[model samples]
Target: MSDASTNAGAGNGAAQTPVQPKMNILAQFIRDMSFENVLAQKGAKGETKPDIQVQVNLDARKRQTEGQYEVVMKLHITNKSKDSGDTLFLLELDYAGIFQVENIPDEQLHPFLLIECPRMLFPFARRIVADVTRDGGFPPLNLETIDFIALYRAELQRRQQAQAAAPATGQA
Candidate 1:
């Protein structure tokens, strides 16, 4: 084939190929972590299981580098003695991951960042929580599987409610 025809054919083939969506986990790290035994020695004496409250929050922001974003998943756990209501332990963890995303449309990016990125980080964060609690003279805290989609939906609903209430409160 002549050089001109070959080049034209190659260009057409490249143009016809679809760009697949891609997500790459560049790095994962514990940005911050804290474990506190509120009662110290007194916290571990009880045989009863503690009432544990776990709260999860997530945030994502674009980085200066193209196609790169940072997602942070924060977990707050507070455990209290069931019988006496004394505080047992307070655990806080901020786990973050750097991701490179390409070819994903803007409409889908928000859900991907809020749900999928944090979902990827949760298992490691859960293991850390369990290990810290077990090493702190308590039973391992086995966190339940989180539903990221549900969390994302709830967050959206909450923000909508807040926005709705803001206008009503302003009128009063």
Candidate 2:
């Protein structure tokens, strides 16, 4: 009787063990980077501060390995002289990370890849931008923190709008 009860208890314990969601970053690195000081000596000599523009974009794709995905965060920055409207400097960087994610529902996977993975990779990318700018004989260009959730939502809206417009334009 005690042996039967022990077996029953073990079965119940196994049923109660829950499968936990998991996300692990396997690796991260700068896939590509380019920095150009268009004006060179002229840019350094200019006393006036240039207007700076920065753009951020995110993309993700599944890797060959199961449960593995690659996410890339691309940053484009440009500085232009306020008075002369000449290009001062331009920098572009593509930073990526390989992540292993499991137990996530299909509905939540897109957000996890677009929002969470990029959030994890942003700081390192930001630091590299700053360092590259400083090393190029200019003051560090510290990027502002990005709002991934908002960006993701905006991207969705933009795509929806484009799809809605496509059929209308095709008929014309």
TM-score of 1: 0.87
Candidate RMSDs in Å, in order, are: 3.4, 3.1
Show where candidate 1 strays beyond 4 Å.
1-18, 41-44
Candidate 2: tens digits of C-alpha lDDT, residues 54-138:
8889999999999999999999899998998888889999999999999888899999999999999999999999999999878
- After superposition, the stretches of candidate 2 with alpha carbons farther than 4 Å from their true spots are 1-19, 41-44
Candidate 1 per-residue lDDT, tens place, 83-148, comes to 888888899999999999998889999999999898888899889999999998788999999999
Q: Could you give me the TM-score of model 2 versus the true structure?
A: 0.87
How many pairs of residues collide in model 2? Answer: 0
